[model samples]
Target: MTTASTARRPRGRSPLHGGRFGLLAVLPFIAFMLLFAVYPLTQVVRMALSHVEIQNGAFIWDFGTLANFARMFDDALAMSSAVTTAVFIAATVPLTLVLGTLLAVLVDRSALFGPIARNIALWPAVVAPVVVSLIWLLILSPTVGVLNRVLIDVGLPPQGWLGSEAGAMLSIILVDVWHWTPVVFLLVYTALKGIDDQLLEAARVDGATERQIFWRIVLPLLAPALAAAALIRLVMGVKAFDEMYLLTRGGPGDATTLVSLHIRNVFFDRLELGYGAAFSLAVVLFVIVVLLVSVVVRRTVRQGGAAA
Candidate 1:
């Protein structure tokens, strides 16, 4: 090629990755991750594995071994709280997914009220969790609660909704579902909207039943959204302390104690910051593992989609 023509030609691909502006654009995000995400994670790790003590009116962290982990494991309340957290996740994730999906489908399929239904579905999510907890606490209170008042009107005894173990756990789960289901509904509903009406029409034109179209087509399309919403719910589920703490105070016994609640108790109440820090690191590890798995699953799904 002539020198003039060669000079006009580019030698590399577009500057999507290597341009100066590209680096500048990404610098803030990188800084944010380092400052907010990485730094906090490192701090948690350091605190967890250190011997933190008050010396000369100052908190001192001496780098040490994993004694805090051992201490956490040995604490009966800590182990129970971890198990309770798992149980809470196991209970809420499925309930939120099922209920959210059903609501999304009902609203999406509605010819007239779909928009209104979708908006209504998001109302619960807009309400703050703290506010929701307070509301539920009043509702579930044994005496003078509207629910109990109604029961008394019907001659049935007013039950202690948050007083007993079974009732406390069940009440927390229900409250969690009520508060978080709207989030799943919004996500799944958005996913449903991405689906083409032409596909559903084609299925119907081929004499496919409503059940067949939904099961074979709609649900499969919604799988990614469902998985995402479920993971997010599980993450939030581990933080289920706000509702349970407000409603039950983790009490009548340790009946409603969650891992976060236990962590708080150890840190603040028991003055065992080292053990709490270790358990907090454990929680961070769990969250990181879950997020990593989510990334892998999403990558696999994208590859499968591209292959198909």
Candidate 2:
């Protein structure tokens, strides 16, 4: 009787916990991440800290010191590339915020054009980065470009848009702004739409101006969304490569030479794999600094709004 009752006892464990097939089903995804993401990251860290040397026609890896990083610091062009990258980030992020938030405000206020304008705004975001770069290159070309033609017709100089140093950097930043404004517009507009209508109504009852309501209530609520957008832009800025490569090729005498291109030049052009890895790690460190700054700024803005 005791054995029969024990055999009939209810089992509380789910199939996922007890079944081999459940764990097996997710094993492939785990393996995929390990193979692609974890393995590459491990290799990068390993390469970043070591010194590679060729002896007797065989490659030898010595992993103990930061000699590669010391070389990276001594390199002047690498430092300049870091500065150029910083400038690019500073220019693009704020412009995207202002343009995106303004467009979002307009769309949020309009009933008729809201939906249509919103769809049109996403057109740039949907396009591939490569395609966008190609389109801009054609439009900004020196001799046969439409922009130059327009300028010439209006009796202005046919400037070397991408051939000059200052022009190259400005053009790259402008292109980034054009591509990312829609992204900002969509993000900020969504946040604006999510506001409680009653809050705005209450503000109106208290004799608040539209500008006053926007500065006090609307802006504060939008802080989190704005911060998120800024973070996205910041990361994108760190990873900026294709546009600078495709458009400027890091040319015009280091004018648009971002750190990513600098890394490519080190690894591919110069064939210094160890140094490239160290520089890549430096780029990661720079990204961390940018992230910390963004977080502090966001927290400060939110606190100020709350205090007000």
Candidate 3:
């Protein structure tokens, strides 16, 4: 090749050249994350280790150690609140997955009222959780609540829905299911549309019944999407705060107090910034563990299915 042509042509692939544009692109994203997510998280951890005391009409900081963590375990109410939150997540995740998947499968097709059904499912998601909690609070009030009024009309006793410790957590779970089911419905419904029709046709041609086709062909194929929806709902449910905060305020003798609620009270309400940071870290650990377990389980299931 001519000297000019050789010069114009590129040399062998170089790592620096390959990553030059990509590095530039990722720099902005990294900067943004560092500024927003990472910085706040680091600050929380820092504050959790430091003490805040009033000095000369001003707040002063002092370094702390295991004292904050020790306090967390020692406080029975705090420990119970954490346990309650975990139970809330365990209860809600499965319920949301089952209901969301069923709704998605049922309303996925283009029927005369398909749009209407889909719209109704999506409505709850569009409404704010705080607003929904307020509305439910009014409807389920001990005496004058419309829900209790309806039950009374039907000859059943009027019950304290949010007011009672026994039923408060259940009420929160219901509200979560209502507001978030629509999200899963929309996601899974879209996933359903992407499933190949030829598989269904092939199953039918092989003399498989409709039920057989659904169980053997459709469900197996939809497992990944269902897994995705379940993970999304799991994370959201674990971190749920707004509905619980608005509806119950962790009331009725701490029956409905969730981990997030406890964290908020520690950091903001009680002004235990350092201890709150430790609590927040504990929560992060929980989230990480759940996610890792879920990924492993999904992989194991997929491997078993492949082997079978």
Q: Which residue pairs of candidate 1 clash?
A: none
lDDT of 2: 0.90
- Candidate 2 per-residue C-alpha lDDT over 138-244 given as tens digits, one digit per residue, 9 for 90 to 100: 88999788899999999998999999999999999999999989988989999998999999999999999999999999998888888889889988988899888
lDDT of 3 by residue, 1-308 (tens): 69998787688955566778789979999999999999998887777777765568776878767677777889887889878977887888788878988898788755887888988889999998778988888887887789999998999998888877878988998888888888878877888888899978988999999889878888878788888888888779768899899988998879999888888887778877778888888778778998999989989987998899
Better of 1 and 3 by lDDT: 1
Q: Write the residue-wise lDDT of candidate 1 on 1-308 in tens digits.
A: 69997788688755565679788998999999999999987888888888887778788878877999888767898889888889989999999999999999999889899988888889889897789988887888897677888899999999998888998889999999999999999999999999999999999999999999999999999998998898899889887777787888888699889998988887888776677789998887889898998899899979998999
Alpha carbon lDDT of residue 86, candidate 3? Answer: 78
Which stretch of 10 consecutive residues in model 1 shows the poorest summed lDDT? 9-18
Model 1 has an lDDT value of 0.88
Candidate 2 weakest lDDT stretch, 10 residues? 10-19
Off by over 4 Å in 3: 1-19, 54-59, 300-308
Please report how far candidate 3 places residue 277 from its true position, in Å.
0.7
Clashing pairs for model 3 are: 48-274
Question: How does candidate 1 fare on TM-score?
Answer: 0.89
